[model samples]
Target: MLAWYTAVVYAVAGAGVLADAGWWPTAALVAASSGLVLKAVWFDPWLTVGVLLDVGVITAVACSWPASVY
Candidate 1:
């Protein structure tokens, strides 16, 4: 399901972070964004925490990125 796919993507992103791969941020951002869309399509009260986590991930990635890329 979408949740499983998102979890796998997040695991890959986490590994990329540990490995210091240049694409980690992009992967994380994509996964987080997809997760947000998924939640929006299938809204649930219990999923609010997940929405917050996705937003946090997006914010972290954006903040840590170099200004030159923007």
Candidate 2:
């Protein structure tokens, strides 16, 4: 199920973050980016909050990256 997959993705991303793994950013980005489409199909006002949070996470990640990567 899509919801189950979503849950797993979120869990993996969270775990990766907590563990400070080098790959966490990629996993987080995947979860956040996919949340955009998933939120659309399963529209909920609360989901909008999630999308906003995802945007914030993306911004934070981008800001943390070195300008050299740009």
Candidate 3:
């Protein structure tokens, strides 16, 4: 049950990112989804921290504005 919910959350977050939605909202959703999944999967503390950090970095990169100055 928890796993299913977590998957759904991740799917929703992925869809949001693919949709090119706003950065903050997408980052927040992804972080929340990852957290839920990590907890549900009972991942090791260090592994979970790593996963979270990766997600945060990815989200930051994705949200970063391009260097092109129109």
Candidate 4:
């Protein structure tokens, strides 16, 4: 039951990202990544690293692009 609930939450969050509703998608992704970091601290440090990498890539892309293009 809990797994089902979590999946539903994640699905809604993914839909929000697809809809391009501004910062909510980024915020949700960050929050979920934080949770993973906490839960997998011992065996899965890569999860946190991946999250940081994602942030870096997004930041680089955003910086490399001009807002006026939007």
RMSD of 4: 5.4
Off by over 4 Å in 4: 22-70
By TM-score, who's the top model here? Answer: 1
Q: Clashes in model 1: which pairs?
A: none
* Candidate 3 per-residue C-alpha lDDT over 1-70 given as tens digits, one digit per residue, 9 for 90 to 100: 6556656765665666667655435544555656656665787666776566546745655665232310
Of the two candidates 1 and 3, the one with more favorable TM-score, higher being better, is: 1
Best by lDDT: 1
Cα displacement (angstroms), candidate 1, residue 29, comes to 0.3
Model 1 backbone overlap count:
0
Q: How accurate locally, in lDDT, is each candidate? A: 0.88, 0.73, 0.57, 0.52
lDDT-better candidate, 2 vs 3: 2
Tens-place lDDT digits, model 1, residues 1-70 = 8888888899989888778788888889989998998999999999999999999989988898554433
In the range 14-65, model 4's lDDT, one tens digit per residue, is 5665675555445555545554544455446556675565466356445643
Which ten residues in a row are the worst by lDDT in model 1?
61-70
Task: Report how far residue 20 has shifted in candidate 1, in Å.
Answer: 1.3
Candidate 4 backbone overlaps, count: 0
lDDT of 3 at 50: 57
Clash list (residue pairs), candidate 3? none
